[model samples]
Target: MRKSPAAKAWTRCAVSGIAAAVALSASLSGCGLPAADPGNPGRPVAAAAAAGSQGAAGNPAAVTAGSRVLNPANGRLEAVVPEVSRTVLLIGDSQSEPVDGWPRLGLAAAGYNVYFCGRGGTGFVSSNGATGNYIDALLRGDWLLPSGTPALIVIQGGGNDAAGAASDRQITANAERLIAELRERYPSTPMAMIGTLARGEAHGGGRRTEVDALLGSVAASHALPFVSVGDWLTRYGLAKDLADTVHMNPAGRQKLGVLLEGRLRDLGLDRKPTADQQPLRASGTRDDGPGQD
Candidate 1:
């Protein structure tokens, strides 16, 4: 009643194949880029282009997505979610990691689902149509919510656009376009755009200040509530809080989330900062108001 040698060899081979397949599946699922649904067939967005944009010259190496820092080479940390949940789509550099993005923890603490769309090295200006400027991609991809509307959309970006190579006016203009596009797409969704965090020697001290001012102007022009994390960094004193001259560490991200919760509440996105946030500010700007040209 003994099995043949050939039979035993086949069994081992089958088990090895199954194990390999399982491991591959697990890896993909964890990354949150599962293959497109079979029943409802359509092409998924161009992930290659998205990946390239994150790696473009002078961009950050990582991005915060959901509750993880996404490595472009490997989508690492893209799918993992913290226990408490409510989605906040982030758009920014490594400075916006889920733990660093703060809104993920803040909104989740207040009971909401959060998703991180943190794209490293992304800017408001089009990368020559490469990644479709964050706002344009959001609208085209319907990034608001699964129901086509989200409770809140938090944007943190533009640090790269603050380059000396580009005039302050140019940076400001690009940011304005970003805000305008978002307004046109998701008119009623409450949005909060964060200013850059810390300044570095790259722009000299003054250029950083100019960047913050231009960002503030964009928020005001759109009438969307703004959170000046850059200003907050100055007020809080940078040396101790920052992990580096530029980005913050995990502890820093937690502080940011706590501060941002209040801003969302003030803008009427959340009721009391301790409870579920409600959408307060109308989604679209004056120009893109409901049914208005």
Candidate 2:
């Protein structure tokens, strides 16, 4: 039987800042959650990069977080650590869940490494029967990120909320609270949002699109950069690419990943220029290259 709000996970790892290159150890604890919707297996802290990036491969799947040593110095559960500008913390659901999916593929292509806090059947307000909602889980230590600050934080999902029975008000409240919490934790880090994937009503799109728009509003309220893909399937004519009504096939995932890569680039979410360094391209194959699982 299928259960709503099933997957919950977070990956932890730390790399020194480029300018400083000072190595700092961070302790992270998160149990892997299988992506329940499609029954995808869980992935630990994985690393992907272009040829010249960290891993030194054309398309290396990822180097799990196991490769790193954790420091129990202060013993804070989710202690504060230094910022690594090349890493991104991603929270998502089925449309592009995690470990392997369009969002991961796209972000990899954009030259950013990922530390995913992904879960299927989970969303802002839609609590997974197994893991609770996003905000509560983070607060209660259900999911703990690496001690260090990531370059950017991205919240990606709304399918669960759209499918869930939670009211719009509840969703907004939870989303707002999560954002505020993250802001407090990583005040200097940039944040972005990837809205719910939808086909639009003409193609049987329902509350998914509505929730996408609602999330967009929420992101805007906080001045968070947002990407709206509510009408992507219909707009991009990817109907044939869908494995079913909602999920996409491998080809679709690649296409969507490419689309997302460009979108993130345009939005300056992937590699926004810092005060010290000029914005430069992250290494990765522009076409037909992804460090996917």
Candidate 3:
């Protein structure tokens, strides 16, 4: 029988970029968020302020969960101050999907309202037969946050591109384009990039290593923080956490989440909640670990 498209995509990522794929999967899955509540979708950090509550002079009467407040003095949204509950925009591939990834969980744990946009089999330089590459998706406005401007924007990928053998020039050009577009849109917001993942003894080390180096160079040129988790599985003793060669098991996912949370904190991207703010939690369960597949 022929493999399904989803299956084929998974196979391609695994076969071409198994080390990268596994590392990405571990980083994301390990940091999975608590299941979302049906009543309160998306904006998990804090409850919405009461409607008609006064904000700065010219701002809207109702303060939505993640909406920008109008600055009465300046009469412009641009002057709006960062709220106690910050917002984060995360863009990546299957590994960092919003469903239950570490980026989502780590940010949420840090009292952030996370907007995640990720597609399986997609990357900075290659789409792995998906609809569009990262640049195309960003240009088309595929993964924008709904309301307020994100305080932090994170871009994660390159595994698929490395696996697909995307040229360094292609990767660098697309990354630059993506950064330029983001800067134009959110000039003041801080940005960061998480590079491709890898295992220490992987056979495809050459390409994955090259992709990691290219990503580092791009981040440096753009003056953005770059976190490389390529050898996380081996370095962190997470080899036994693999559900497969390219995906993490439940235990591995938990470990990855802890590791990522620390990284985010170390970079100063993840902040603790203020006294009045509360961390987001699911209605039923407190434990946010990924369920059995």
Candidate 4:
């Protein structure tokens, strides 16, 4: 008897110790959120092509305080400074949980103060009995930070939904509801969505393909930057970087951080470190709290 692809993926996830990752997510502590870098107070850091552009090297240029640049990724023209005046919010599932997950690390590396709200095994449409689903959490104010409004918001999920065989209509409806709620709350805040993960060559043909497509369509309708990182592991030659079928290891996490930095830069959403900004800790631990559900 042959194992189904879904079973194979699930087996890989279990073998990779995803359970441990969830435990780690729960034990993590929030860092002492730092202020902007104090060295260049009040001055806007100028964006240099080398520092702001995403090329084949996959390396993100160091952003200075108060720089303005055109992001080649999403063709959005915007300033990178003033980010110091706000925070960034990330909402996602297990893949984006764990203090050291790529999305959180990447946003922090790019000079933004980040607040992450991740629930392992949860998705835009899937509910974690404790905190409910992403939309429910937001609606109930369970994920709000104890500070100012976020300058940007990023939503990452779909893997769990796809794995569970959630219907296309279900995913889309839930996604639209999530986006609508977010827009109603923060009408002007910039938002982006990331799709499911998969092997490089198998991306467009993988199990989560439909979920990814629906996510892209939703993003398109909202005119938001929608990043499909399914092939990132294979595209960047980080196959060995995966800790499981869907999660990234430390090395993989670092690589993903760089990739996300480049993507944010491309979307003109990269943050410029303020003079008061503090440096990222070597341990890469700056989460606000444990996974809620």
lDDT of each: 0.46, 0.60, 0.57, 0.60
TM-score of each: 0.56, 0.68, 0.65, 0.64
Flag regions of model 3 displaced more than 4 Å.
1-85, 128-130, 201-204, 279-293
Residue 237 lDDT (model 1): 46
- Mind giving the per-residue lDDT tens digits that candidate 3 earns over 159-278? 778777789999999999989977776777889998765664364446665787789899999889988777777777776777655557645655565566568779887755578765
Rank candidates, TM-score, best first: 2, 3, 4, 1
Q: What local lDDT score does residue 172 receive in model 3, on the 0 to 100 scale?
A: 95
lDDT of 4 by residue, 1-293 (tens): 99996456445434333323432332221121123322444433222422443321364344433333444443322233323255676778776776667776666556566556657777877776565677776655444222224678888888778777778888889899999977766667789998876664464436566677789898999898988876776676777776766777766765677677667778787765558865332112332233221
Error of 1 at 187 (Å): 2.4
Cα miss at 280, model 2 (Å)? 12
> What global local distance difference test value does model 3 have?
0.57
The residue pairs found clashing in candidate 3 are 28-102, 30-253, 30-257, 31-101, 31-102, 31-257, 32-100, 58-72, 198-230
lDDT of 1 at 290: 16
Best-performing candidate as measured by TM-score: 2
Which of the two candidates, 2 or 3, achieves a greater lDDT against the reference? 2
